[model samples]
Target: MFIKIPLHISGLWYPIITNNPLTTGSIGAGINIALYLTAKLRNTEKCGILLNNEEVLKDHSRAICGKLGVNLSVDEKSPISLGYGFGLSAACLLGLSLSSLLVKNITIEKATWPAHVAEVIYNTGYGDVIAEFYGGLEIRVKPGPPGIGVVEHIYPGRKVDLIVSVLPGREDTPSMLKRIGKETYDLARKLIDELLEKPSVEEFFVKAHVFTSKIFSYDNIDKLLSPYRSKIIGYFRKKQALVLWVENEWLDEIYSYLNKYFLSFKTWIDMYGVRFENTS
Candidate 1:
């Protein structure tokens, strides 16, 4: 069995804050880029994981070794750096849950619940699991487990290219939420409402820029993108990274610039969410 799950790029999300600590997911409104977690089952003398990160073994992936001789290994790319839009934590858990279908048949909703709960418990992420579960640019209207939480997707009808670059930094999502003043949250919600009115890839980023401005300072961003700011569809700093949604014409120039200064790559947004296949 082989499964591929898309990573969530929530560099832009309006957290749905609540008093209850257990219900602490966000109202995420952003699309997913093509970075992935790939897993496959193979026959081997002993069940083992061929991985570079020890945390994967110490935590989520170890519990599901299944029966002996069932060799399942998951490989992730780009090794989502610290404060780098989740470091693909949700993607790793989702892949593990999806692979369980090969051992025991279960509904998709059932598969995703554990992954979402684990994410919340560990404080690694919030609405990202649900966001990746649905794919596309989603507004998580209800924040909780997958079976109960509801998401409204904004379909761009075409895959959009998003340029990403990680910087050495840190962002505590829960702390960031607490830091946001009520005025900012309310205004961001109003922006979301406006997005639903005319939801397009272009418009989503246009609004994202406004949302980002209220939360953080992007002074360095202006100087870096001065020459090509006009072509930018959306620009924001998230997870200690810089993500830009831009017009295609200037993609190469901007990409080159990003590569020169930061660890950058270009990936496309997908609406299909997570996909898996039996490769044994």
Candidate 2:
């Protein structure tokens, strides 16, 4: 049986790795609790996840079963879990990796893991959900979780253009996190604090972009994920990659090429310009 799991936006990357936990602002990273209904499974009754993908599911499931000394098989009737993490590849990488570690403690693993698993969802909790709802670019505060603290939501209606470089090989999020250390996070916090002093949304965009670029340009990063570098860079030269136009005019053209080039590993999921009618 097919099941649709609903998620509630709870925490975000920025807050989760902040120097001062008190500062709940905008979340540049996205995080959520995936509440799963496991009635389909004959053995396990229910399970929920705070993960971005199923890569660590098998290991996690194994840990849980081992600890409890009960063998739970992944039969055809097993419960299905699905999650989607879009935007900020780095944050997604971190969150997903951390969750995997948490699952490993339980001696349980994912019955099945997806091809690509994000480590974390990096977004300011403020606009992650709103952006997901509207399916557009958003400019909001850091540490942006809903109803957590004094963190407020402000939609500037400004277009934040992105240039993403999708490389072939996967970067190790755990290793990268270790290398970044507290100093890196502190620098980001300081920059964010400065931005908060006056609070200019436009200025914030420029600063945020700079911060993002710095993270992306880390020496280890460029070298680790070089396979898709050329392709991601190539997109920048294309008018569509740089500009913000939400029209399906170029949908077929783009996918046709993607299906041909990244046939082995990559495929387009949801094109920004496409419109879906509500039939339900």
Cα RMSDs, all models: 4.0, 11.3
The pairs that clash in candidate 1 are none
C-alpha lDDT values of all predictions: 0.67, 0.30
lDDT of 1 by residue, 1-280 (tens): 5677676766445554466533667665776777666655433333334333443533544444442113455444334543466437777766655655666577877677666666666666778788888777777777865676778888777646678877556666657666778787777778777877877777777777778777777777788889888887777765566778878877888899988988887877767777876656
TM-score of each: 0.81, 0.38
Cα displacement (Å) at residue 38, model 1 = 1.9
- Estimate the TM-score for candidate 2: 0.38
lDDT of 1: 0.67
Best by TM-score: 1
Clashes of 2: 57
By summed lDDT, the worst window of 10 consecutive residues in model 1 runs over 62-71
- Per-residue alpha-carbon lDDT of model 2 for 65-166, expressed as tens digits? 443344433222112222222222212221222233222453112211110111122221223332222222222353322223223333334432222223
**C-alpha RMSD (angstroms) for model 2:** 11.3
